[model samples]
Target chain A: GAGVSQSPSNKVTEKGKDVELRCDPISGHTALYWYRQSLGQGLEFLIYFQGNSAPDKSGLPSDRFSAERTGGSVSTLTIQRTQQEDSAVYLCASSLARWDTEAFFGQGTRLTVV
Target chain B: AQRVTQPEKLLSVFKGAPVELKCNYSYSGSPELFWYVQYSRQRLQLLLRHISRESIKGFTADLNKGETSFHLKKPFAQEEDSAMYYCALSKAAGNKLTFGGGTRVLVKP
Candidate 1:
């Protein structure tokens, strides 16, 4: 892809259900990131992946939130037992490398839990 | 832990007026700072980085280590410049990027 791509631009899920958000980073990019954008709270760092391995998962809000990247390319963010507060725009970004490089963002997936 | 803060939630200015968005960060080690902007219905894009010491679209940000602040400023605000601005910090080595609560700028004609 020319830029980072996120699937299901909009997702609506019921409480207690699990949802999966996908991200396809640019080709040959070695680093990927996930973030949540909610009202007032701003953009919260969720996870960081360096070549299919996530070294930084401290930003995951709770046990219900988990993510994984495969082939150092596509990534998935899964949320279990979704709550109303979980509704937010999930953003994915990719960079050439981890060290101080510019990150390119996707259109973002707006997940709404009702 | 590293954290970024944008004190203003909204900034309103008329066309040709000067606009400044304040950003502050809390980090123990050296950090790289960047400014990102998002226009309506568009994805977020990098505006400038402190390391570059360059201006973009008439906007520039200076990283002050003394105050731990990276403030974005533009001498003349344009209607097209109305967008949500975010300040981000990246630590040395391979570390996650932290973003501050964005500031929404509204440039009126």
Candidate 2:
């Protein structure tokens, strides 16, 4: 697919359990970003990965949240000890370059924490 | 700090009517603004960027530095154009983006 791809379109997990969300960005894109959208709220920046560079994790809310981009293509966002507040739509986006360019987004993973 | 704001949570208009979705941003440096749209059951996609200064699907947004706004406009609203629209801003020196709460436009025939 030409667009950014995300797995587990929907997930239901209990509190204290851990969950991992995956993202497959568009081919040849060098920059990827992760954001979370809570109900009726705006997108909250989570992390950013540039090709072969140190990721910008400033947006990450807590230590339990971590992400990695392997081979500069696919990325995963892991949340440990999931709390009820963790429920939201996790969105992944990729751009051909960096901030100066436009980005393509995926359908997003809707995680529901109970 | 960079911030984007969309005052209207929802806007409704009749088909063929002119429509405008307001977007405002607060950034200290050069501003990079973008308008993204998400149709029903679809992923959010870029609609237009202020730098391009191009009209997409008859939609155009003018970057107002003085007003600190980038309002999207279309001569005639179409049913297919109804979607959730978000306004975002990224400061020139940063990779992080600030997004607004989003505005949903509904076009009725």
Candidate 3:
């Protein structure tokens, strides 16, 4: 694709239910990132994937949140036993390189937990 | 640990006026700072980075180590500049980034 793509642009899920958000970064891009934005808040770093493996997982808020990228392309963020606080826009981005490079972002998936 | 801070939640300016958005950070190692903007209904995109030392759409940011500030500035603001701005910090240690709370900039015509 020309740009990063995210699935389920908007999602509504009940509290305690699980949710999965998908992201497909730009083709040939080597770095992928996940960020969360709460209502009226800044972007919060979640995890990063260099290729198909996540080398940085320290940003994950809690154990309930886990993510995986397969084939260094498609990535999925899974939130287990979702809480109301989990509701936020999940954005994915990809950069040409690992550092000091411009990153392109997806439109983001607006997750609503009720 | 690395951290980024955006001081203002909202900033409004008239067209052609000068605008500045403040960002501060805390990191022991050398830090790279970046400004990202998200226009209405659009994806967040890079406005500029300190390393590049380039200006986009007449916007510039200078990284001050002593003060730990990286503020985005524009000499002449346009209504099209209205957007949500974020300050991000990255160090050589890892691939992760620390972002500050965003500031919503509104440029009125």
Candidate 4:
């Protein structure tokens, strides 16, 4: 694809419901990242995947938050039993490589936990 | 643990006025820094990176290792420069990028 793509630009789910956000990174990109953008919290790193290495999950806020990148090209962020505080924009970015390269961001998935 | 700090939450300046967005980071190892901008209704994009030592859209940022800061600056701001700016840091070996609490710049006409 020309740029990073995310599915369901806006998602509205009831509290306690599980929601899944998807990201399709640029072709041939080896690095992918997920971030959460909230009102005052700014961009919070959620997870990062580089090639075939073990993903760095240090940023996942809780057990309910999980992500998986399949085939190193597409990724999914799953929020289980979502809470009101989970309402925020989920962003995905991809870069040619992890070092000294630019990361191209997606339009972002706006999740609204009602 | 690595961290990035953006002191200002909001900065308002008149068009053609000089503008600077302060950024500071705390990292134990060598750091790579970058500036990203997001205009209204647009996706976030890279404005510049310290390694490149280049300017984009009339904006430049200098990495001061002594102060652990990478501040974005522009001599004359333009209305189009109004956007949300973020400062990010990553390890030299390319770890996950850590971002600061973005600063919103509103360039008045």
Query: What 10-residue stretch in candidate 4 chain A is worst by lDDT?
Result: A94-103
List residue ranges in candidate 4 displaced over 4 A.
none
Q: Share of real interface contacts recovered by each model?
A: 0.73, 0.75, 0.73, 0.73
Worst 10 contiguous positions by lDDT, candidate 1 chain B: B89-98
Write the residue-wise lDDT of candidate 4 on B12-99 in tens digits.
9999999999999999888889999999999999999999999899999999989999999999999999999999998867567889
Q: What are the clashing pairs of model 4? A: none
Model 4, position B31, has a per-residue lDDT of 84
lDDT of 2: 0.91
Q: Rank the candidates by lDDT, best first.
A: 4, 1, 2, 3
Candidate 3's docking class is medium
TM-score, cand. 1: 0.96
Worst 10 residues of 3 chain A by lDDT: A49-58
| Model 3 lDDT, residue A19, Cα | 96
Residue A82 lDDT in candidate 4: 100
lDDT of each: 0.91, 0.91, 0.89, 0.93
- Model 3: fraction of native contacts: 0.73
The segments of candidate 3 whose C-alpha lies over 4 angstroms from its true place after superposition are A52-54
Per-residue CA lDDT of candidate 3, range A35-104, in tens? 9999888888899877645458878999999999888889999999999999999999987666677788
Compute the lDDT for candidate 4. Answer: 0.93
TM-score of 4: 0.97
Query: Candidate 2, after superposition: displacement of residue B46 in Å?
Result: 0.6
DockQ of 3: 0.71
